[model samples]
Target chain A: MKKALRTIIFVTTDADAVAAFNAYFNPNEVQISHFTSGMGAIQYVKQIGEADLLILEEHIKPLGAVQTIHYLKDNMNYSGGILFFSDSDKNEIYTDNEAFEVLKKGFEKSDLDRVLGLLSNKKKPVELNSKPYSLSYLINLSEGDDIFIKESIKIFNESVGKRILEIEELFEKEHYKEVSNLAHNIKPSFEMLENNLGSKICDELAHSQVDSSKLEQIKLLRDEYMNVQECLKQDFPELFKRV
Target chain B: MQRILIIEDNPMVVRSLEFKLKKDGYDIVVAEEGRQAMKLLHEEIFDLILTDLMLPFVTGTQIIEHIKKNYPKIPVIVLSTSTQEDIITDAFKMGVDDFITKPFSPSELSLRVKRTLSKL
Candidate 1:
């Protein structure tokens, strides 16, 4: 027997949105509940247990998307994925995390289908040869400008390399606290690129715990940085001069 | 055209916001850190302020405090990734007009800016 679609809690004040959702997803296929207010939705979830997915409308009056997500995450400790939908041009604020996605009012059923498919799959699809260069950061930052992409890559190539050297010098001087803070700051950039090795090294260096072998963590971070640099040089040969 | 100041450290965010706001015909000035923002606030008059909560040299709260004390006439909006309730509550108490979180859509930001300006 095939498994049933996950339960989805669709929270919204808009009548049209509710109608759209009802028309799209069959009730029998997936468990669905509709709440008109953020507080109401929260209460429903609290009464039962967690919903597999939360489809939140950005403009839910007194509770809104930000406050609702805040309460759910901070107070309730709800860990399910969230899909934010907005009918207007109001900016929806959210972090770039594994369980978060956004959809606009005009999105069709296919868009919702694609997002739902991704959310249902436990394992994320891997990109081919992601190790050579983590391009997602630039892809987002540049937004498809060829010149802008090239310039950003060049700047990252120069600035990140310099910062790595600075971190090494700081480590050599035994300024561990400074190293920790610096690593903490740089870790987000690596994480955005999906470079797990670089992010892991940074996390190890940033930890407040002190050990005799902590310098080894810095050395590992340095090696990871070199690998990234080499990868960039090899992939974008025109951007870097032969050393 | 309305003149606005953007105080943010992230270069990507700055570029995106500046592009959209400028296209909407707002005159803009940018500062990459809290101290630079302070300097700009003193040197020029602005209709509104958009700032990130986490900044170097000075924190966003400190900047908001300074604005409330001296530039109380200007409306302020916060754009940050901080999820702390105390931080946000404190900003509202200090008289910030609005709050937005990071990774927000540009269209949404533009609309908020327009609405806030219209209210002012």
Candidate 2:
């Protein structure tokens, strides 16, 4: 029988940290839940009952990391392996507890791999086919309400579809800041649609400096958005029909 | 009916939020930009405010500061895609009542809105 993938709950408010973890972990091997605050992590734990591990930043707030760890262990009876991310010199503060391991800030992939290996046995990797875009997330968000799904699609078509054109014009005018802002604004729409390629392109565009490379990214995002839009129209003909 | 002023420029997000919150039966008013939100804030009273951190004409932080100083009783909830700790911490320190990340679950949205309003 195949074993279940390990669940890792990562608590941090750093976008870079979240991006790093997302890039490192194989989805088939580990399922990760990210939360911005320790309280958010606690709420998730309360909902799911337990996870295999909890990785948190030393500076997590609302409830600090130490207090969060205590609440999870004592009040929630959580027995998961806990990992703390702190400055290399500050490892001594957490080293006192033998149960917890400290990861230095900006730890590399090998460091993460070593820590995971210590916590659990490695499972054989499996291959799976995944789509570039999926409405499963949107369907779930709508709770199977087709009307809401159709409306959201229409809104995406009208809003994001229009904004991309404006972004192109803004880039031409050298309004790099506006171009970046526009990318930041439409990013969530791509995420909501589960268009990872488009979302990733938007993330890059959101931070890119004024250069020819930024235009290349915008073109890529446009192509991806167009592809997703085409797919959505075909998948939901009724939704796309003239109203 | 409890009133919620939603300050967001994204039509897709606005539609989703409006759909769910209306189904939950709150009187919803939307402001596409921070300036419009400020005008509405001065003209009519709201029980709660659901605002995006990024907006045109005025920023969410500036709007929150205005609300904290002028309309201290109205509870504000921030909607953001930013995962930056300093921004989130600053919003809380500026008197934001709650924070909801984007691409949020509808069930969670319902629950958070209910929870925030119940505190009134």
**What interface RMSD does candidate 2 have?**
4.8
Q: Could you give candidate 2's per-residue lDDT for residues B2-111 as a string of tens digits? A: 99999999888898888878877999999999999999999998999999988998999999999999999999999987544578789999989998988776656876
Candidate 2, residue A148: CA error in Å?
Answer: 1.0
Judged by DockQ cut-offs, the docking class of candidate 1 is incorrect
Give the C-alpha miss distance for residue A172 in model 1, angstroms.
3.5
Interface RMSD of 1: 5.0
Which ranges in model 2 have alpha carbons more than 4 Å from their true place?
A1-130, A208-210
The alpha-carbon deviation from the true structure for residue B15 of candidate 2, after best TM-score superposition, in angstroms, is 1.0
Looking only at chain B, model 2 earns a TM-score of 0.96
Model 2: per-residue lDDT, tens digit, A141-192? 4434656767888888888989999999998998888988898899989988
Backbone clash numbers for all candidates listed: 0, 0
